[model samples]
Target: MTAEPNFVLDLTLALGTSAMGGYIAHRLKQPALLGYLLTGLIIGPFGFGLQTDVEQIQALAEVGIAFLLFALGVEFSLTELKRVRAIALQGSVLQIGLTTLLVASVSLLSGSAQTPLQGIFLGLVLSLSSTAVVLKTLTERGETSTVHGQVMLGLLIAQDLALGLMLALLPVLNQPDAVGLALGLALLKILGFLAGAIALGRWVVPRLIQHIAATESSELFLLTVVALCLGVAWVTSKLGLSIAMGAFVAGLMISEIDYADQALGKILPLRDTFACLFFASIGMLIDPTLILNNLSTILELVALIMVGKALVILPIVLGFGYSLNTAVKTSFGLNQIGEFSFVLALGGLEMGLITEQRYTLLLGTIAISLMLTPLWIALAPRVVDGLHRLPMLKDILNRAEEPKLLSVPSDLSDHVIVAGYGRVGEVLVNVLLSRGYSVLVVDNSETAVQRLRNRHVPLVPIPFVYGDADNELVLEKTRLETAKALAITLPDPATTRLVLQRALAKAPHLDIIARSHTNEEIDVLTQLGAREVVQPEFEAALELGSHLLNTLGEPPFDIQAVLTRIRDDRYRTIRPVAQVGEA
Candidate 1:
């Protein structure tokens, strides 16, 4: 019998190893991509030599890249992007230009590149940050809606959008004399593709998707979406453009349709499966012996990338007029080289812009930087605290202009102080005003404060403080001594806890009510001296249960008693219990 192909066996090994690696990374509080990379390293040529069909695996990995960018395009939200358009557009462009310039200068000085074009290529490779890792980290930490989180995401979105142009521009860098001609051709091709995509999105996609949905067959819908994604990617490859770029455009076509959410939902499983292979393939390219031989050099490079990138981003955010705390946090969160940089580096390698050894170094550096991103973000608060303690830095970091007061009486007493103006705070403030209660709002978000200012309304003119509620100076401005109660509704648990502690410190007998974002936060906030803690999800459940009982013809008093009992016991009966030896 003829020897059988090893493709199936290789794929199985790759998937199994990646799954176990991902699980371990999750348990250890790291991004699953880190585990996938480690798995690839182990089973690859440099590791145990388990994978025999590396070429086939890499070909499938290309599909993963296509699907990954496709999903991103489908999930793209114009509304959210609009919220931070200034930073997302102008800020990201500035950041990319500055980072590339700095890296090129350094590469030339160190004699790492033979020519200016090669140096520029090297700079481009390192300029992008990993969106997958940073976003997953932000979601895990419950900071997605925080100011720094929003800013990081906005910058990341812009970077990802810029990748398509970067891919097109890389080829032009390979040509020296025909640079302008090559660039013009690239732009023309991109414009032609975009026009075709827009035309499809505007007319064809909606009708096509609607008809597909009318079939009411899940399998058929999924197959259609997959075909569309692959077909566009194939076309782009034929046009001498990146397949990933075509896939993204295909996704944008789907995004404009009413079935965008359903399409995304159907394609997610396939995207994730293929995306795993892509990350694994990247890992397979890393050589362990090379890394071991140059361990110190790799570590040094990782540090330089993280610190240098952070320093570059810090002032850019500060220049945009965000607070020092926000700027610092955003910088820390995005200091590492991103996953998309691998795509650019691979393109460079293929175009002969960089050598094999240099490609290996870039891969290793990117991996290490991504692995450290989560830990770096976790340390940001502590870094901010240290900065705040330094006498020279304190004033500068804390210098926020006070918000203009609106129609405030000199004798403002026996009123409530609301520490946040988010969804919960907004409603609470409206209710308090409706009930003729004097209210003072304290918020850190410049956008939120600006919105509050623009509400020229039927409601009473509100007084507000434009600074972090956790800061003592901000609390002092809230007239804590004369306030009837304090409501802590900040989305960040750490900030909420700090606000509660600081408010109580200023007025020992203040009746402070705090909001809990997680189950564990309830006990922590109570222990920190909150008079009452409210878990929004739990409260919603209680309301639903009470309504169900009343609908069954039960007495109102009886329903009230049941809810009261649960609340009186601090939700001990309904809260989730920890399993044995659970972390």
Candidate 2:
């Protein structure tokens, strides 16, 4: 008897290829999502043709998209969502509206969009900026706490919230004859879903999670979570909306529960696996011959998508009262078309609102834009600096005023400047104050400053400067030139290097001691002119060794001598030696 093949082998092959591609992309210092896409391209029907069941692969890919949105909803905390509500909601709406109006006009005039529906769909797709790419890049650079980073995050969150609404309205837009009625009906359905979701979230979902969590079986809990996500998604699909919307709502319901973190931890791996497949499926849709024949069009579209969006967003950010540097960085970070655009594009194609050729072009252009996102983010700081040097833009750049978030004594001098109010910073602040030295804290977190103000510590009043330590304006307020030493407690190497470099430039003789997390960072920080670079892990090891020696009745003098030797040798003496194993 002959045996029939199953889809399991197909699934394994897809994941294996994606893993290999992701590894290669990592080695090349690129985003892994790009690798996944390339992998799909290679194995897809249009390429090497390894996978025969394209329909099955695509069906899984849809589930992947749902999980991706679900993960996004879970990570977005209500506190964070509420904090950026004004700018996120209003700024995003304005940005989307303006970008859509302009893009639609351009499409109509160019004859690319034969009907208003196609133009509107085009506008909507282009209006969304990639949240995953921007967030990943910012987190890697450790800029998530910076003003520009916060603004970008807020805007991305707003875009995510608006995604469901956009998905619902897209189908209605396809119906030109009953556009108004369809739109109204869609809105009502969405509203009903929201109301029902809120009620479930408040009354039922939390208790359901509690019961599932009480089982204490990780496997069962995971199964239940998946079921919830899919169940809500199925409900939305029945109501003529996207499964992604339902998944997002399911996530929101769980987010307020105590088990949210555990749920996130359990689901993240699955979400990532599926998300990789989703990107791969997108790559599979690309026809290389089509791209080869329309290379110029692809290049032109990429330019419009990346450059046009950036130019549009820059003014929007600036108008929101952010500085030019912040505005520039935020704009560049969000310039690329988003992952959700793929969903919308797929919807448009299914409805015949766009041709397959146009869909391929969008995929190609979006890929190019996403690939360029990291480079654009890297250039933002330098671009801001260059613009400040130009006589024309200098005035605008200099117009940024210092925020009145903190008060520092005007006569402060010979104090220590602590650049961060995290655990280390707080410790440094207390020690400095106890030793009768005036300390100034430079932290970007407003919440940290508020906590400091409310603290009931016995030490004398500590002056705080609330802003990014890397900003020269903030550094100047710290009286860096007069300060005896600068203690950088910030854990981010990028921020640490920037602050160290800027402080040296401001005052050549300023003594700076910075924290580092890696040997490479230690070297980098030291080269950047930090007087002392302390790696926490090494220090902890040293403390442990000292305690063990004391317990063993080793002479205190001997212990001190060994510790002094290690410190004097810059930890070279205590650094672990590499061992060779017998073959």
What tens-digit string does per-residue lDDT give for candidate 1 at 1-583? 7545688789989999999999998789677877888899899998999999888999998888778767766865444445677988799988888888998899889988888888888877787887666765775577877778878978986776577667767767756677777667766877797799888878988898899899999999999999999999898877766676678678878776689999999888887788778778878877788888888989999998899999999999988877677888999999999877877889889999889988888888987887788889988977977887799977765555333333345788998999889889999998988798888888877667777887744654577887777766667778899999999988777678778877888899999999988777788888889888999999999999999999999999999999999988778788877611131
Local error of candidate 1 at 401, Å? 7.1
Candidate 2 local lDDT, 416-453, one digit each (tens): 98998977888888887778787788886655788678
Model 1 TM: 0.83
Q: After superposition, how far is residue 263 of candidate 2 from its true place, in Å?
A: 3.7
* Worst-scoring 10-residue span by lDDT in model 2: 574-583
lDDT of each: 0.81, 0.80
Error of 2 at 39 (Å): 2.0
**Best-fitting candidate, measured by TM-score?**
1
Estimate the TM-score of every prediction. 0.83, 0.82
Among the numbered candidates, top lDDT falls to 1
